[model samples]
Target chain A: MQQTKQRLLTGNKALAEAIRLEMERDPNVFVMGEDVGVYGGIFGATEGLFQKFGPERVIDTPISETAFIGAAIGAAAEGMRPIVELMFVDFFGVCMDQIYNHMAKIPYMSGGRVKLPMVLMTAVGGGYSDAAQHSQTLYATFAHLPGMKVVAPSTPYDLKGMMISAIRDDNPVVFMFHKTLQGLGWMDQLDASIGHVPEEAYTVPLGKANIVREGTDITIVGIQMTVHQALEAAKRLEQQGIQAEVIDLRSLVPLDKETIIQSVKKTHRLLVVDEDYLSYGMTAEIAAIAAEHCLYDLEAPVKRIAVPDVPIPYSRPLEQFVLPNADKIFREAIQLVNE
Target chain B: MAISKDHLLWMYETMYKIRCYEDKMAEAYAEGKSPVFNIGAGPVPGEMHLATGQEPAAAGMCVHLKKEDTVTAPHRPHHHAIAKGVDLNRMTAEIFGKATGLGKGKGGHMHLFDPDVKFSCGGIVGAGIPHALGAALAAKKRGTDWVAVAFIGEGAANQGAFHESLNMAALWKLPLIVVIENNQYGISVPKTASTAVPSNDVRAAAYGIKGYYVKDNDPIDMYNVSKEAVERARTGQGPSIIEIETYRYLGHFQGDPEVYRDKNEVTLLRQKDPIIRLRNYLLNECGVTEETIAQLENKATFEVDQAYAFARESDYPKPEEALEDVFV
Candidate 1:
C-alpha cells in the first residue's frame, strides 16, 4: 500500500515554505519588497524567510514600487529569479508601467531573445473592512494583459505548488493571494483556509483548474477565496437537492476554459462567483467564454455572483454586503439550477 | 586634459557613423513618405524618434563601457544601440522590420535587445531607469564589477520611476550611472517649462548621490564625466547622475511639424556640433591628422551604406511570427 504524508498549513505558510525551498535550491532566487524582510510582509506571507535566507537573499526595499518592481524585471532579464511583493494589488497604479510595460512586455518585445523568470506576488481580497484602496482583487486586470501568467491559488496545497511552478517557469507570473485565505493569526479565517500541504517541493501546473467537488446539476467556477465560498455553497446546495460542481481556477491568464466548458456540458448550468468587480472582470470573461464556446451547454443564461461595481466600503456590513460569499453563491447556484 | 589619439579617433568614428546612419534613415523615410502618409506602407514603418544631435552622449559613455556592462536606452535609442556595440546590420534590419532584425521585427526601433552585449531599449519614458538599476543590482549581488547605465532624457527625470530608482540605487549602493541627455525638449514641451529645477543633475542632491553637469556638447567632456561616474559605480561608490545639456537637430518624431522651437535654434546648435568640435580638438590638440579623419569619415559612410543595403535586402517577417515571441 502507498503512504501519503501531508502537513496542515495556512495559505501564507505554504507560500513561504515554497519560497524557502526555491531559495535553498537556487541561489539566483531572492525576495524584495516593502516590509518583506524584518517586518515579515504586511500580511505575514514572508514571515521567517528573512531569518532563514538572511538579509542578502531576503531584502527589504523602500516603498518605491516602480524601482523595486522594475529592478525585478531587470534582474530576471539577467537570469535571477526574483520574487517581488507588491504590498497590495490596489497599489498597481504606482508601478503598472513596470508590471505591464516592462515585466509583461519584455519577452515579447525582445522577440524571444530574453526570458523573464520573475514572480510578482501581491495580497488581494477584502473581508476585514480595509477601505477601497487597500482591499481589491485585480487579477482580472493583470490577466487581461498579454505576456503575463496570472495565478490565484485557493488552498495551501495549491498555493505551495503553484508558487513553485511560478518560480520555475520562464514567463513572468503574477501570484495573487487573498488576505482572508492566508489564515494569519490576527486575521479571521475559515477552517477551509487550512489544508493538507506536502513537505516535499512539488508543482501544480498553471492553467489547469482543480475540480474540488464533483457534482452533476450545475457548474460553479470560482478563484482564490471564492473557490472556498463555492465549496461551501456546494455543500449547502447538496442539502437543497441541487448538485453543484465546484472548480478552483488556479490560474487566470491561461484560464482553464476546457474544464469549465466540460463541466458546463455535463451540468447544463453555470454560475461564476468572484470577489472582483462585476463588470469587465473574471466573472464576465467566464460568462462570455461559456456563451461563446458552450452556449448550448448552458441550460439557462449564465449567472454571475461578484462584488458589485463599487469600491469596497470601510463599514463591516457594507464590506460584507459588497463581497461575494457562500450565501450569494448558494443563492445564485440555486437560481441557475432552477432556471 | 590630454586624451589618446586613438580614443579620440574612435569617438569621432562612432559619432560620424551615427550621423551617417540617421541621415540615410531620414532620406529613406522622406522617399517612402506616402502622399497620404501611410505609416505601414513606408520602408521604415511606424514612428521614428531619431537621435540626430544626441550622438555624443551615447558614443562618449558607451566608449568607456565593456560588452558586460549593461545599458538601458530610452525612445530615441539608435545612437546608444550603435554605440553599445549592437550589430549594425541587425539594428538596421530591425528598423526596416526584417525577419533577421534584433527583435525579429517584433520590437521596432525603440524596443531593441542585444543580450550578448547586455543592451536593451524601450519606447516608454523613464521606464529604463529602474531596469538599469536592477541590472546593476544583479551585478552587485553576483559580486561582479560590471556597471549598468541608464540613458534617459531630461523629460524622463520628472517621472516617478526616476526619483524612485535614484533613491534605491543610492540606498543599496548599486553600480548604476544615470546619464540624462538633456536635449532641451520632451517631444514639444521644453525642459524649462516642465521641470521645476534648473538642471536635471541638481535632482541628484535629493537622492544624496553625486551629480555631474556638462554644459557643452563635447564628447570628450562627456567621456571624462562618464568615466568618473562609471568608475565610482564599479568601485562600489554607489550611483551618480550626469546631465549633459544638448540639442536635437530633428523633430521628436518623423514628420513632427516642430512648431515648438525657434526656427534658428537647430541651425545655431548645429554650428556647435560635438562631432565637428571633436574633429577640431583631435586635429589641433590630439595631433590627429586630417588624412586619418577623412579615412574614418569614409569608413563610417561605407559602413552606414552597407547597413542600409543589408536592411533593404532583408525580408519582412512571416505573418505567423507575431505569435512566436509573446512567451519564452
Candidate 2:
C-alpha cells in the first residue's frame, strides 16, 4: 500500500499553493484582482503569490470590476490563463455583465475558435456577521448561468486539487471558496477546514461527487461549508438508529447526477443542506432531481435545510437563524429518516 | 505630412467597401422586417445597428493596424469588422445565422467575433473598452509591439468601463488606442442630453493621456490622427483617445422612427459625406484618375453582392451544434 503523505493546510493556503504550482508550470498563468498584489488578497487566496511571481504576473487592479474582469476576458481570449478574484461573491453585482456576458459567453460566442482558460475565484458564505452585502454564497447564481463551470471546495485537499483543475480547464470556471472554511487565524475555524493535502499536484476532477461518509438509512447532499455541516450531522445521526450517507457535490455545473441517483436509490431518503437561500437554489435543484428520477425509491418527502430566504442579518442570532448549521441539518435529517 | 497615393487609394477603397456593405445590410434588413418581431422570420434577423455614415472612422483607424493587432467595437461593428480585414463572407454569413459564419451562427451580428483577425464586439455599450485594454496587456506581457484599438461612441464615454480602461491603460503604459465616434446620439438620446462635456476627447485629460478632437469627418484628417496614435502605441508611448465628429446617415436601427434628431441636421450632414470627400480628394489633390475611383467603387459593390449571395445560400446551423461550443 502507498503511504499517504500529507501536510496540514487552510483552504486559502491550499488555493494559493495550487496557484503557485500552476504559475510554476506555465509562464502564461497570472493573477489579477483588487488588492491581490500588495494586500495579498482580501481573503489570502493569493498570499505570497506577489513575491513569487512579481508584479508583472500578480496584478493589482482598481475597484472597477467591469474593466478588470472584462480585461481578464480579453486576456484569456488572447491565450493567457488569468486567475481573477472578485473579492466576494456578493460583489458580482457590480460586474455581472463581464461575468455573464463577456467572460462566460465569449467562448460559445466565438464558436470554440477562442478558448478562455481562466479562473474567477471569489470568497463565499457567511459565519461571522459580515452583513448582507459581504456574506453570500452565490454558487447557484453562476450555476444557473450557462457557459461557465462552478465549483466549491470544502476541504483543503479538494481546494488545492480543484483550483489546479479550474486553472487548467479550457473553459471559464468560477471557484467559490467559503470564507468560514478558509481557517484563517483571524476568523474562527472549523475542524473540517484544515485537512491533510498532498505535496504533489493532483486534480479531484470537476463533476464527481465524493461520498465522504457512507450510510444506508438516508442520503445527505451539501456543498462548500454545508458539506462539513452535513458530515457533522451525519455523525450525530449515527448515534441514533439512522445511518446517514453524506455526498459532497464538489462541482455544481457538471454535476455528478449519477452518484446522487445511486445514493438516493440506496438510502431511499434525501436531505439537502445549502448555505445559499432556499428558493431556486441548490437544495431545490437536488429535490427536483430526486423527484424526477428516483421518485419511486423515495420513502419520504425530500427535505431541504437552507437559508430561509432572508438576507444575512448583522445580528448574530438573526444570522444564525437564517444559516444552515449541523443542528438544523441533524433535525431535518432525523425527521426525513423517521418520516 | 504628405500622404502617399497608394495609402490614399487603399483608404478610399476601404471606406467605399464599408459604405457598400452597410448599405446592402440596411436594404436586406428592411426587406426582412415584418409587422411582428420574430427572430427567425427574416433572412437577416435581430437588431441591425448599421454604421451607415461612420465608415471613415473605421477605415482611417484600421488602415494603420496589422492582422496581429486586436480590435473591440460596440454593437455597431460591421464597419470595424470589414475595416480590420475580417472575412466578409463569414461575417455576412454570421449576420445571416449560418453554420459557416465566423461565430458558427452562435453569435449574431451584434456579437460577432473573429479570432483570425483578433476582432470581437459585444452588445452592451462600453463593454469593449476594457477588453481592448486586456488584449493590449497580453501583447505587452508577451513582449510584442502589437497594439489594440477599442472603438466606442461619444455616448459610451460616460460609462465607468471607459474611464477605468483609460486610467489602467495609461497607468500600465499599455499600447491601446480609444477612438470615439461622436455621431451625436446614443440610441435615441442625443449627446447633449447624455454627456455633460461637449467634447469627449477633453475627458481623457482626467487620465493624463493625450486626447485629440477632429472637427471635420474628413477621411484624410482621421487617417493622419490615427497614424500618429497607432505609431505612438507601437513605439510604447502609451495610449491616446481620439474623438471624431461624424454623423450616421440612417436611424439608430433600420426601423427607428428617429424622433430625436432634427431633419435638417441629417440632410446637412449627408452633404459633407466622408466617402464623397475622399473621392474628391483622390481626384483633385492626390492626382488619381476618375476611372480608378470608379473601378474601386465597382469592386466594392461586387464584393458586397458576393457576400450577400454567399450568406443567403449558406445553411443554418444544426440544432445540436449549440451544445458543442458551450464548453471547449
Candidate 3:
C-alpha cells in the first residue's frame, strides 16, 4: 500500500478512521472518552465512532478521567483493547495517578504477568484559541514513566501506524497528536519529500527517527510540527549553501538516539527544534543525551529552538511570536554551522 | 438458619488473624517501623481497619469459595485476604513492604497481592471494584465455574468505580458477588451521610439483579445469606448485591480518638462481637472443644509471626527495580 493512495485525512481524522478500523477488526476493541462518540472528541479525533461502534463501545463517560481511565485499565486487564482519549495533553495531571501509577505499572507489578495494552489519545499544542490549560506539549512527562511508550506522530500515516502499533502493544501507550499538524494537508508535502511509506498495520517499530532529508552540515532534530519546521529550515539553509540534516523523532520515549547521534556525527553540528517550552523537558533530555554521546561531534554547542518560557498567550501576535517557526529553526541551524 | 461449626471456626480464625495483625501493625506504626502515613492516608487512629467486629461476614461468605475463584478488595482487606487463602507470611511481608511481598515492596501494606490465593489488594478506595468486575468477566469468558467477589466497605460503595462496576456487571450478566459490608461508617461519616438507601440491595432493583441484606454481625447469618449469592453467581445466573449489616469492634481505625461514638456504643457492640458470638456458639452449641480453638489461635499467631519474619528478612527491592516493573 503506497502512502498517497491513502485518501485525504488529518492526524485527528486519521485517528478517527483507525478507531473505526480497529473496532471493526477486533471484536474486543472499544473507544471511550469525553464526547468522542457523540460530538467526536473535543478535537474530533473520535468523530462518528459512536454511530459506527454504538454507545456500548464508544462510551461517553462522565468528566471522571481518573475513574474512566482506571476502569479502562481494569477492562484492558480483563482482555479488552480500549483506546481512551484524554481530550487534551495537559489535563493528564487530573489522571496522572491512573496513567503513571496504575496503568503504566500494573504489568510489571504483577510480576511480568499482566499486560495493560491500553491506548491513550490526547490533543497537544498551542493554537486554535485553546488556553494555557489546553495548549502544551507534555509528552515528556509520560516519556519519563517506566513501562510506558509515548508516540507523537506528526502526519496522518504515522498517526495511523503509531496508533495501530499502540493498540497492538501489550504495554500502555500515550499517543500525543498535535493540534497544529493533524490532517491530510501535509500528505502531499510529506509524500513529495519523505517519499513512499509502506501502508498496512505496519509498525514503524518505535524509537526510530526519520531523516526527512540527508545533509552533511548540521543535524536539526525536530518533534511533531517542529520536524516540519526543521524541514523548511533545511530547505532555507540549503539555499545558504549550508546543508542541514532533518531528523523527526516521532516517539519521544525509547528515543532513537542512534539515528540522532549518527546524524550529528556526520553533520558535525546539532540543533533541536520542539514546540515545547525551552525548559527542563524533552529538549533538555535530548540535549543531555547528545552532549553525553556526541558532544565532540558537534562543531558548536547544540542549540534548541523552542517557545520562550511563558504561557501560550491566546492573542494572535503573542501565540505566533512564542511558537517555534521555520525561520527560528533556520537561524539556529545557520548559527550552529557558522560556529 | 445457623451456619455449620466449620463456618463459625473459619470466621473466628480470619477475624482473629486480622485483629492480631492489625494490632501489631498499629504498634509498628507507632514505633515508626512502618511507612509515614499522615492523618487521612489510611483508616486512621487505627493503623489498619482491623475489622475486629466484622469477622463473621468475611469468613462465612468466603468459606464456600474455591481457590481459583477471585476477590478484589481495598485497604480494609485483611479479612478477605485471609479468607481467600493468601499466605499470612506473604500478606505480612507485603504489609512490611518487603520485596518478598506480593507487590515486591512497591504496593506497601496498602497494596496486597496474591493471585495464587485469588485475592488482590487495592490501595485506592473504590479502585478494586472494577478489577473484580473484570475478573468476573474473565471468569465468564473462560466459561469457568469460578466467580469473582468485590469486597467493599460502606465508604467504597460510594465510589464511582463501584457504581460503574455494578452497572457494567449487571449489564453484562457477569458472575460477580458484590459484597458491600455496611459497618455503619466510612471513616467517621455514618452510612446515613452517604446514601439514602441504607441497604445496597435496594439498588439491585435499579439494575434488575436479585439483592439481599444480611445481619452482618452473625457469621452464620452472613454465610446463609451469602450462600444464595455464591450459588447464583456460580450457576451463571449473574451477579447479586448483598449488603452485610455488621459493626466494627474498634474505631474506624485503631487508636481512633473515637470522640464521635460513646463508650456505651462500643461496649454494646463489643458485647455482641462476632468473634465472641461465633466462638461461644461453636463451643456451647456446636461442641467445638476449647483445645481445638486454642490450637487454631496458636497456629494463627505462629503463622502471623512467620509472615512478619519473612517480611523482615526479605530483601528490600533494589532501587532500579522501581522503574523495572512499570511495564512488565
Off by over 4 Å in 1: A1-5, B34-40
**Could you tally the backbone clashes for each prediction?**
0, 0, 12
| Higher-scoring candidate on lDDT, 1 or 3 | 1
Cα lDDT, all candidates: 0.91, 0.91, 0.76
lDDT of 2 by residue, A183-213 (tens): 8888986888799998889988998899999
lDDT of 2 by residue, B175-265 (tens): 9999999998888898889888889889878988889888778788889899999999999999999999988988888778899878897
Q: Who is ahead in DockQ, 2 or 3?
A: 2
In candidate 1, the residue pairs with backbone N, CA or C atoms under 3 Å apart (3 or more residues apart, or in different chains) clash, namely: none
On residues A1-339, what C-alpha lDDT tens digit does candidate 3 reach at each position?
A: 665563556566677767777788887788877888788887768878888878778877767677567767766776778888898888887777678767776676665556777898888887555667878887667777777888888777787777878888888888888766654342223431222233345565667778878999888888888888788878888889988888889998778999988998898888888788888877888889888998887788878877788878887778888888888888777777778
User: What are the per-residue Cα lDDT tens digits for candidate 3 across B173-218?
Assistant: 8888888888898888888888887678898887789888886477
* Clashing residue pairs for model 2: none
Better of 1 and 3 by DockQ: 1
lDDT of 2 at B136: 98
Residue-level lDDT tens digits of model 1 in B1-328: 5556676788899999999989999888776576777666678888888999998899989988999999999999999998998999998999888998988999989999999999999989999999999999999999999999999999999999998999999999999999999999889998889999999888888989999998877788898888889889999999999999888999999888899978998889999989999999988987888999999999999999999999999999999999998878
